[model samples]
Target chain A: MIEAIGVSKRYGETVVVDGVTLRLPRGGVTAIIGPNGAGKSSLLSMIARLLPMSAGQVRVDGLDVARTPGAVLAKRLSILRQDNHLPARLTVRDLVAFGRYPHSGGRPTREDAAHVERALRYLALEGLAERFLDELSGGQRQRAFVAMVLAQDTDYVLLDEPLNSLDMQHAVAMMRLVRRAAEELGKTVVLVLHDLNFASCHADHIVAMRDGRVLMQGSPAAIMTPEAIAAIYDVEATVHEIGGRLIAAYFA
Target chain B: MTAARDPRLVLAVLGALALGSAALFMTWGVNGAWGFALPFRAAKLATMLLVAHAVAVSTVLFQTATGNRILTPAVMGFDQLYVLVQTVLVFALGASAFAGLDRRLLFAGEVAAMIAFSFLLHAALFGGARRSLHLLVLGGVVLGVLFRSLAGFLQRIIDPNEFAFLQDRFFASFNSPHHGLLAIAAAMALAASLLGWRALRRWDVLSLGREVSITLGLDHRREVTRILVMVAMLVSVSTALVGPVTFLGLLVANLAHAVMPSFRHAHLLPAAFLLAVICLAGGQAVLEHGFGFDTSLRVIIDFLGGILFIALLVRGKVR
Candidate 1:
């Protein structure tokens, strides 16, 4: 389980994430959906210890995320932010192999290689394994980055805006991959999502945020209501139940 | 990308290039007395080779740590300050009086100042907020220009003979190189390279930038601090040896990146070292023998290196 106790991120008097207390249980996809500048990314980064919180604490499993050694915490959790630009030109296979660095400490053994291969396969990036990251399309690059994170093979995977720059088809495929990672691998997956309908359709738990504070947190049925969507996004969104899933129609 | 472009193959080619340069530098033309000329030439050769290694390795490692290919230590006003130190020395004591000072004291004082300058620059610019690398580069370039103007201003006040003497010492001509400091510099550079080897192991993670490095459990702050300290030491060693060749670092480090198949420092560092050796030794040999000592080695490196720097900028690679 990931626990955040009054986590706050302040940058010189401008509070981005303000005293947000929450618990994200393990083994399910928790989609943090909010408008831009709503502190979704900030909140996710705080939980993963990517950014130092101005106050409060976060713990992954029973270990304090802030206090644990990075290598030890790395085995428990991994994070992939939206922009994964690299100065060095790296092939998909080479980039994925870096995920094993925390475990093997730069010298990957046979078992590490197997994990890398599995990650490549998981993302359906096997064909593009030899291709450099810069040469790939944005969507493919997104998948390749996710492949690297998956290759980390941690108990918890935190993704910040993982669906950015992804087209509809690729977005659906990526979400399915995230869901599969949760169900099959039993990994705890938390992600910042842009599209509310995707969260409504795919996320088991939804946490809505606006103005650096959590508006609500519950199952999709409870958090996907029309008023909840409006309060979170400041846009009139109609909620519809289709095929036993709450889908938000906000594009109109 | 190609089987023919295997890293081992590139390593062999670069190794060959280094060896070829060393051989030519050692035995280009031996008309003078064997005992006197050979050892004298060997000191210069050794100095050039050590500076080459120091510049290349320091730049590559510094770039790796900062995740910016364009920000060589020299670009960050490392060598500019060295020049400023020499200029101020000459300006204060006059060339004749400055020459009377102990060379080792002068060298030690200059190295100490450069080390102090590096730490101050890093602490001031890199603290409080995590400044972007481009901001750091901009700050460095601005400081570099400031130092150059200050040095130029000092040079203008000095006497004509003193100005010429200072120019002779500062422009990085292979002729009249500092022979006495070769052993000290070479040892310092060697110790630095050995210390840097540990940091190089985790460079792959460090190369990924701050978040990923931290995510992988690598202490990004500690590693960058270590690498920057190493850079300060290496830059001091090289500049104390042969004046500063700012563009030389960019040339060799970028070449190593372009030549290597991976970012593994194990390969990049060696490749960069060989390229640096080849550039310095070969440039020295060509100047000594091919051009009959007509021009300064620094002149050639600066001209070509400046153009290459502009090319890298135009290509949108530096940012």
Candidate 2:
């Protein structure tokens, strides 16, 4: 379980993430969805310990994120941020191998190699393992990054807008992979997503945030109502149950 | 795609070039004074190699920290900062007294100042959220100008004779390095390598940018700070030894990248070091023997490296 107590992020006078305490359970997919300037990314970053909190504390499985060593937290938690620009050129395999750095420290052991191989195979990147990252297409490159995060073998994985630049097909593939990781591997996945329908379809729990505070939180079934959507996004939208899944049409 | 040559093979070729140049610098144009010339050339060779290693390693590390290829410690005004510190010391203590000060003590003081300045600059410029490339370049250019202008102002106010005394230390000269400081520079360089040794793996991870590296469990701030301190020590070693060679680091590091084409610092570091040695010891040989010119090697390198810097900027390779 990940617990954030009175989390707040203030940049000078502007409050980005307000003081809010929340608990994220240990398994399945939990998606944080919000409009722009809603502080979803900032809140996720703080929970992952990637960004420092102004006046709060986060505990990941009883270990205080601020006090615990990064290497220690790394074994239990891994985060893949949006729009990573690598300064150096690396092969897909070389990049995936870096996932074991917290464990291998650049000198990969036999077990570390096994993990790398597994991740590459999982992402169907065995053929492109030797290819440079620059040579891969957008979706392929995104899969390679996800492969690296998977090889980390962390119980909790935080992704900030994993589908930022992907087309519809790739975005669906990414969501399926996230759901599979949670179901098959029993990993707790927390992601900041922009597509409300995708989140409703894939996420077991939905967190709707607005103005730096959690406006609502519950299962997708309970939170996917028209009134709840209107309250969170200030949008006039109708919710339809299509094949037992709630889909919101707000684009009109 | 054409197969890239093995990095190790490239390393071997560069190693040979560095060694061949060292030999030529040591043996060429000898006139039956092997007894006296051997030790003198040996000292010069050692000093050149130490400075080469220091500058190459520091510049590569600095580039790594800033996530850009064009900016080096020298470009960030570290060399001028050293000169400024020296000029301030001379202004406060008088030229004669400053000149009378022990070279080792002076070197130590300059290195300490460089480390402090590097830390202050990094902390002030990179405050977690403001890491734009423009701001970094602007800060570096502004600071470089500030240090140079301050040093020039001090030089103008001082006496002419004292200024002449100070002038010799301003321009880089490989012909006359105090023998005593060579050992100290080597010691410092070795200490820096040792300090930087453990961070080697972390450097590769760091090249992935701050977000990924921190998520990979690296203490990003601490590691960058440590790398900067090591960079400061190295810049001081080179600047104190040869006054200041502005673009050698940039030239050699970029060349290393061009030839090696590997992101791993394991290859890049040694490749840069050997290239620097070739440029220094080898270029010195070519200048002293081939051209028979009385000009310092620093002048020729600065001329070429300045052109390369401009070309890189014009080519839009700042990232």
Candidate 3:
């Protein structure tokens, strides 16, 4: 389990993530949904130790993230940010292979190769594994990045805005892959999502944040009420039961 | 598999060409005094090779660390710092007093000052604030301008004869290296090269960017700091050896990247070093023989290297 206690981040005079305390369970999909400048990405970054928190502590599996060695924490947890621009020319397979760095330290063993292949196969990227990441389409590149995180095989996977450039079909497919990873691989998946319907349909738990603090967090059934949606998003969202899923409709 | 073809054979051929060039450099003046002429030219040859290797390796590593092709150790105000140190020495103690100073002591002083400056700059800029790399580059440019202006101010105040001596020291001059500084520079370069080789594997991961490197379990801050220190030391040695050759490193590092066509630093580093040596040695040979010794080899290299740098910038090959 990943736990954040009184975690806060301040940039100069402004507080970006203010006093966020939450516990992400061991195995399931948890979605953090919020508006722009809601500090969702900042919270995720602090949890991953990508951005240092100004106050409070974060622990992963009882190991203090700030105090623990990076290598040890990296084996247990991995994170993928929204924008990843690399200067080197790398193929999809090569990028995926880097996921084993914490284990093999860049010298790949036979088992590492097997893991890479499995990740590529899981993402349906086996055919495009050898192609350069720059040559692939936007959706394909997004899948390749997901494959890399899956190849890491960490217990806790944190993805910040993973659906940024993805189309609807690919976004659904990506969420399904995340759900599968949680269900089959028994991994804890936390993602920052924008679309309420997708979060309602896919996530086991939904966390709503407004301004650097959690507005509400519970099952989709509990947090999908019209009053709660309006309170968090400041828009009248009519909650309706569609295909046994509580979907939020706010457009028009 | 074909893409992964080992560059060892190509490296061997380049090594052979270097050796052949060295042999020619040695025998080109064989009929002169054996003791004085041969050893003097040999000292020049050794200094050239060492400086070339040092600059090439440090520039490539710097580019990898910064994730930009155009920025080099020079861009970080390293060469500017060297000039500042020289100008300060001359201004404080007068040219004659500075001339009387021990060459080894002077070299050590220059290297120590540069290392300290680099550490201070990195720590100050990247320590607290979450500033971007571009900000750091901007700071470096500002510092470079400040150092150059201060050095120029000191230059203007010095006596005419002293100014002449200082001017000679400013421009790169391989033909007249202080032989006493050669051994110390070689040792420093060798130690840095060893450290760089040990970290070669991590360098490939670092080139992927910060988030990936962190996710891969490499401590990004620690690795970048260590690489920066090594780069500073290497640049100091090369600049102290033959003065500053600003664009040679840029020219060679980019050429190596273009020729190697791979992201792996294991092959790229050696290729860069060899390319540097070949360029320096061959350029010197042609300047001495083909050009009838009419001009300094530094002029030729700077001319070509400057053109290549401008071309790279115009073509947007920097990032």
Per-prediction DockQ = 0.64, 0.73, 0.60
Off by over 4 Å in 2: B2-4, B294-296
Tens-digit lDDT track of model 3 for B238-293: 87778778788888888887767467888788788878878787778777878778
lDDT of 2 by residue, B1-319 (tens): 4266789999999999999999999999999989999998899889899999999999999888877888888888888898898888888888899879887787788888889988888878886585777677678889989999999999999888888878877654688875667888898899999998888889999888788887788888888988898998998888878887889999998998888857899999999999999999999888989988778788899999999988988897568
lDDT of 1 by residue, A82-110 (tens): 88558556888988998988999988999
Best by TM-score: 2
Chain A agreement with the truth for model 2, given as TM-score: 0.98
- Candidate 3 residue lDDT tens string, A132-234: 7767888898898889998889999999988999998999899999999999999899999999888999999999998899888999998899999888889
Better of 2 and 3 by TM-score: 2
Give the candidate number with the greatest lDDT.
2
Q: Which residue pairs clash within candidate 1?
A: A70-B217
Alpha carbon deviation, residue A216, candidate 1 (Å)? 1.1
lDDT of 2 at A33: 92
Question: If you score just chain A, what TM-score does every candidate get?
Answer: 0.97, 0.98, 0.98
Model 2 chain A, poorest ten-residue lDDT window?
A82-91
Model 3 sits at a Cα RMSD from the real structure of 2.7
Worst 10 residues of 1 chain B by lDDT: B171-180
Q: For model 1, what is the alpha-carbon lDDT of residue B303?
A: 90
Clashing pairs in 3: none
